[model samples]
Target: MKIKLSRIDDRLIHGQVATVWAKEAGAGRIIVVSQEVSEDDIRKTLVKQAAPPGIKVNIVDPEKAVKVYNNAKYADETVFYLFTNPMEVVTMIEAGIPIQSINIGGMQFKTGRTQVTKAVSVDETEVAAFRKLAEMGVELDLRVVATDPKGDFEGKLKEAGL
Candidate 1:
């Protein structure tokens, strides 16, 4: 399986992701690797429903995602991986998935999380996970849409003092 794009979007498969990002990635499949979402039948159904027409959507847990990635049955698949957090990305990488870079698309603000970019916010745990990803040599591309300029994720993390 080829990774066309790997993104961290809290909202998962929404308008921008179902349309813009998916199209930009040119992936035949969109795999949402989130343990929580995978366990929730309602969320899985909703996410699959939100996908663009003619494209397959799979909501799998981190372990299952790694299995799917290593499965020979999917060798010819081009996939766009949408993750909800940096920790899951770290999990995939640690599990032997060759994810080279990750796009920090949208991480909404919530209590205990500091806003880094307009579309991104992070708490201490998230910061640590992102730091680990960086240490692992994963290029962090911060952007909202495909047309938006890629912001400096490392610099933004520094500025936020995260």
Candidate 2:
């Protein structure tokens, strides 16, 4: 499958992603590659239901995503990947999914997490995973929507003293 855009958003299939980012990426399919979400029937169902008309949604674990990506089963499909955290992105990448860049969209406020951008919050573990991804040549695009100016995610992490 061709990766149009990869994003780490806690709200997986929200308004901005369902409309703005999806349109910008021209994605035919949204692949929510998160083990936790995939196993949660209610969340998985809700995410699938939230997709824009004409776009397919696939909720799968990192392992299944890697297999589908490597097998070229969706070679003709333009896929936009969504993950909840940077660590899951790392997992998928290490499992052989060829992700070159990732959009740090939304990481909800939580205890012990430092706010990097207004919409992004990260903790020590996430910062480490993001650093690892950057070290592996993955560009991190920090943007809230298609209209927002993209910022440097790693730089923001550093600025936050991560």
Candidate 3:
């Protein structure tokens, strides 16, 4: 399956992602790669019910997502891969999933995370992962929505309206 973008947003299947990025990327399929939503078949079914029939929504576990993503399908259509959190992206990378870059749409401020932007919060470990991904030539973008796209947090956070 061809991927348009790997987006990390706390709210997996929401308005901004389903409509904004989906259209921007010209994506016909949405692969929701999350353990929480995929592990429970009930939630998976419910999310499918939430999707617009024209678009394909496959709520699969990360492992399955990677497997399907790497299966070597030569499709002309683009697929948007959505993850719930940064760790999911990190885990996918660690597990050999090829995510060139990721966009930070939204992440909840957890206990140790310092609020870096209006919608982004990063702790020590998360910062390290971000930096590591950056070092690995992955472009990490920071934008609350499609209209307000920004990125390169460690270096460009101050330049952008964080």
Q: Pick the candidate with the highest lDDT.
A: 1
Question: What is the alpha-carbon RMSD of candidate 3 to the true structure?
Answer: 3.2
Could you tell me which residue pairs clash in candidate 1?
none
Which stretches in model 1 have alpha-carbon errors above 4 Å?
none
Per-model TM against the reference: 0.98, 0.96, 0.81
Please rank every candidate by TM-score, starting with the best: 1, 2, 3
Per-residue accuracy of model 3 over 90-137 as CA lDDT, tens digit each: 777878877897988887787976777777766667676777787877
Please give the range of 10 consecutive residues that has the lowest summed lDDT in model 1: 153-162
List, residue by residue over 11-48, the lDDT tens digit for candidate 1.
99999998799999999999999999999999999999
Q: Write down the TM-score for model 2.
A: 0.96
Off by over 4 Å in 3: 73-77, 94-96, 156-162
At residue 51, give the lDDT of candidate 2.
Answer: 92
Better of 2 and 3 by lDDT: 2
- Rate residue 110 of model 3 by lDDT: 79
Q: Best candidate, TM-score-wise?
A: 1
